[model samples]
Target: MSDDLEILLTNDDGIRSTGIRALYDALSEHANVTVVAPASDRSACGRSISHAVDVHEHDLGYAVEGTPADCVVAGLAELGPFPDLVVAGCNEGANLGEYVLGRSGTISAAVEAAFFDVPAIATSLYVPADDETPYYEFDVTTDDFAEAARVTTFLAEHALDAGVFDHAAYLNVNVPLPDGDPAPIEITRPSKRYEMDAERNGDAVHLTDRVWESMDPESLPDPEGTDRRAVVEGRISVSPLTAPHATNHHEILEELAAAYRSQ
Candidate 1:
């Protein structure tokens, strides 16, 4: 970690997303920030990268015709100087539960950066639960993201010095929308509640996934230590995660190996 640090900023929600813009403004105040992000919304794209991407310069930064992973790869490998940290999102929607982590483009960007040995942070804001709300309905203006941006910038400024990434490649942060008062910050693990349903329509089937719809504000089953619980309780959730998959040391694999040796 040098005295002069360079940060690569990217997002799943394109360069012009209000979340990214708010983050860029906040980070620019503390570090040398470079924004290289998807030109269009790439939410839930996971770690998929484009084979060939077309990039163009926007007033805000470099806009790439690709996924969030492509932006990080191009930014670190070709577009700019190697960064001390990679910050993704302030995503419009919350990416909480364990099932959603692997599907979130914001988290995938951080995971991709971790493979390159750069510490990263993926952030999102959880929209409050309301039945009247339309699907993907959240007013994430630049002002609404100030608190999240502040926290992210503060972490970026000191995370390296504090050795936060020594044991983890990236951190996933989810901030609840500000409601006049500052929310408490909590370190949490991803929750394991999944809500997916499919319905039949004539010959074709229509699939509907409504995880948020099932979230009961009065009584969520998740314990206090989970990301879903924290967010539901109006707290900022931070989950430190590693990039590599965990290994299983089951007897089945050992037996298979032994059988192969006997053959």
Candidate 2:
């Protein structure tokens, strides 16, 4: 790592989002931060990248007409001053649970950076509600992000120095909304629970996902060490994870090979 720390900041909430701006302001104090985020909201876009993108210079940073993954890739590979670390979000909503890891653009950006062998962190705030409504709107301005941003900036500055990424590629962080004091941070794993249901209404079928509605702190089935549990308990959740898909036993392949040899 260089003395002058270089950080590539991005998010799924677009360049205009308050989360990204707050992150940039908080990180600028410690590192050389550059923002290259989506031009429009690309929430839950996962790791999908645009085939061709248009990049333009904005007041804050480069605004790319693509997904969060595309911005990170283009920034490190093509853009100048290759960053040593990638930081995605201060996202408006939390990206928790195993099922959400593959569907969250915030986490996906970090996963994309990890593929390039760069250490990354994805940070989000868990809004306490039953629906997708933001507890803090985009236009609302305040220093409410101080707690989340402080911890994120601290990790961004020292996580590499502490050899935190030696065993992991990226970290998924979900910070609970500030409640007068900073909460304890917990190292957790993604919970595999999912709440998705569909309803048939005449000709149109309503696809309803009740992940938020069902996320009651009192009724959660997650264990003490899980990400969902940490967030539910009002603690900051940090889940260290790898980007590469793990290889498992292939019984079908073994049977096919044996059959071919016998024939």
Candidate 3:
């Protein structure tokens, strides 16, 4: 990478979110940080990108009228000073588990950057998942993001020099809401447990997961070194990830195809 690293900063929480601003303040200290994000909250938008988008220059940076993925695309393709690294989020909520990764707009931005061959990091804050303090009910102010900002800045400053991205395309980082100066960082993998629950109403089906209501470290089923386990135990979680392309090496599929051709 270059000595003067160019960092592309984005988030699913939109351009004006405290998460993004906190990230900018921290990252700008070490790199040429450019903020390109949705104009409004586009949480859980995943990697969906529109064919055409409208971008407006704002005081903070460029606001794109699109999803998190769209912001990455526009930034890498059209925005100047092509980034050496792409950092997404400081998102309002935790994105843990293999299943949740695909649906998270925060992680999606990093995935998009990986396809562009740029190393990326997706960061999120883990609000206590409880009934009264529901994940969606918590408020994340700029002050609450100090710990995340610090870690993100630290990684951005040193990861490349450390060759952390040599084999990984991107990293997914989730920080628990600071208890007291935050906790230690742990290398983890996405938890495999699936927690989506659904109930049928008279005419509409309501899908929900009561998992958040019982997120205490002692109550969770997450194993010792998983992302969910780490965050619930008050540790920051970092999962190295890759954006995989399909391969035609399945023998079973090949046999099935041969049978169909014979028929």
Tens digit per residue, CA lDDT, model 2, 158-235: 899899999889999998878888789999999877888899999999976576676788897877899989997899
After superposition on all CA atoms, how large is the RMSD of candidate 1? 1.8
lDDT of each: 0.88, 0.87, 0.88
The digit string of per-residue lDDT tens for model 3 on 24-117 reads 9888877888899999999988889899999999886799999999999999999856998999998999999898888899999999999999
Give the poorly placed runs of model 2, Cα more than 4 Å off.
1-3, 131-141, 250-253, 260-263
How many clashing residue pairs appear in each of the predictions shown?
Answer: 0, 0, 0
lDDT of 1 by residue, 172-245 (tens): 99998888787778999999888788899899898666777766768778877999989888889999999877
In candidate 1, which residue ranges exceed 4 Å CA deviation?
1-3, 260-263
Q: Candidate 2: deviation at residue 30, Å?
A: 0.6
Higher-scoring candidate on lDDT, 1 or 3: 3
On lDDT, the candidate that comes out on top is 3
Q: Candidates sorted by lDDT, descending order?
A: 3, 1, 2
Worst 10 residues of 3 by lDDT: 129-138
Better of 2 and 3 by lDDT: 3
